[model samples]
Target: MNDSSADSFSPRLLRQAQEGGYRLINAVSLKEQLERGSIFLVDVRDRADYEAGHIPGAICYPLPLTIQARLFKRWWLKKLLCNEGCTNVVFYCQDVNSLRSDSAARAAVISGFPDVYNYPGGLEDWVSRGLALETGPCCEPEHHL
Candidate 1:
């Protein structure tokens, strides 16, 4: 896994998130968060990729769809973040360097989500760590907006 440095897009996003007071959780920490529950994990990949495999319990909220429906969707996502008992809302994609997850995280922060997080390690790192994945469709059938 590549480290997000100052010059990279990932790091720039990371910095932006940090500037907005959002955390960037690593794979290990995210695994712990998953086990603890009460965290909303969002997979920002496309629907097909999400259906193929994703971190267990992650909701498929494709980045493209989110971007296309920015105004209302941002409000919807912020509401999800504010759901009762939710401690944090995390977004991830295929890899640590993926811009999709970063954009999603940024959007969440911009939407007034105080506890938004970017999981840079993403699904690849999660699988590399021997973590289990959920196959088939996510809870919502029509992931594409």
Candidate 2:
């Protein structure tokens, strides 16, 4: 999660994230969870990608910010990402090939969010499954609530 180009992918980071105990979630289960309002979905891709399209109700806490270990522990972030009776945290990126969610999942796990998960299918699988996406730029933080 360096200041590298947005196209960067870190396999090592992904491996470390999985090894850190964040679980993988498939698109089917992700959709079900979303329908039930039982998971807090976070899009960890770049802002542009998020604006282009993303899962509805997903909080656009982009890659570079979500990957930071510091923000995950803050009170404001906890309020933003850990709502709904401490619902599970699910981070996703562009697709399975991207490591943004994995990196963010690892950070969430390290921050003591015991129910963190990574959605590898991401926007691609979601769209392939005919699931809908909300196309628009991110709104103010208060709007997330």
Candidate 3:
């Protein structure tokens, strides 16, 4: 974790947080879940990216501030509204290489949200696979860490 004076992500810390908590999910599995029962999809990308286009039903949580994850020195699990979760929760961002999804999933786990899923392929994969995206605003974060 970096000090608040810094905003860089530490790979080692991210790995430590993930441990056995994060579940790696692909576009296929994500889409299937999206079509079914209670599932919370959180898009951890910047707000603008989310507005441009995002996975349908995703709520924006932005980044850095949401997780702390100590990737930013605070990892405030207590601040997350984990009880608001459904049967499953998935966190996602730009694509495969982004750490945002990993950090967000870790946060959900620490907050005690069960069945946390991390979609590494995120919006890019959703769109690339010819899936539909809801263009306008769907939901936003009412609270954050």
Candidate 4:
């Protein structure tokens, strides 16, 4: 098995991630977020991967480059977020290290959203727990696949 930081789900490290302006949500907390209906869930993976499966209701937008390069193609993305009045933006990707997902969260911060977060375990974790997922275009051409 490939060793990864995601395997080390530590309370102390989670606290540090929070302090560094990144929120880490577990299956339980993620469930709570869904129940509350206050979070904007962003999947930072390619289109094919997303279509194969993903967390239900997650908006696929890829990451960093996509967010910067194709605003018009993803207009509705911003529109929904605007309507949600959401304070938290959650980003997730396939990689457990989630460096890309973390970068996406940082982009959200740069875009002026204060409560940006990262779900490092991503769809891997979501599916492993048997959480239902939604499938569709979910993203723009910028997804690159």
Best by TM-score: 1
What's the TM for model 1? 0.76
Which ten residues in a row are the worst by lDDT in model 1? 1-10
In terms of lDDT, which candidate is strongest? 1
Query: TM-scores of all models?
Result: 0.76, 0.73, 0.72, 0.70
Off by over 4 Å in 4: 1-8, 11-20, 64-84, 141-145
Instruction: Kindly list the per-residue Cα lDDT of model 4 for residues 1-145, writing each as its tens digit.
Output: 1112444576654764665566676665676786678777788787788888878878777654554543433443444454446677787898575566766665566566667777777878888888888778765433222
Global lDDT scores for all candidate models:
0.73, 0.71, 0.66, 0.66
Model 4 weakest 10-residue run by lDDT: 70-79
Query: 2 or 3, which is superior by TM-score?
Result: 2
lDDT string, candidate 1, 34-93, tens digits: 787857899979889999999988988776654466555555665554444455888899
Residue pairs with clashing backbones, model 3: 69-75, 70-75
In model 4, the clashing pairs are none
TM-score, structure 2 vs. true? 0.73
Residue 143 error, candidate 1, Å: 11
* lDDT agreement of model 3 with the native: 0.66
Per-residue accuracy of model 2 over 1-145 as CA lDDT, tens digit each: 0112212325654465559677777777788888888888888787888899999989887655442443543334555665535648888888877767776777677667868878776899799999999988875254142
Which window of ten consecutive residues has the lowest lDDT sum in model 3? 1-10
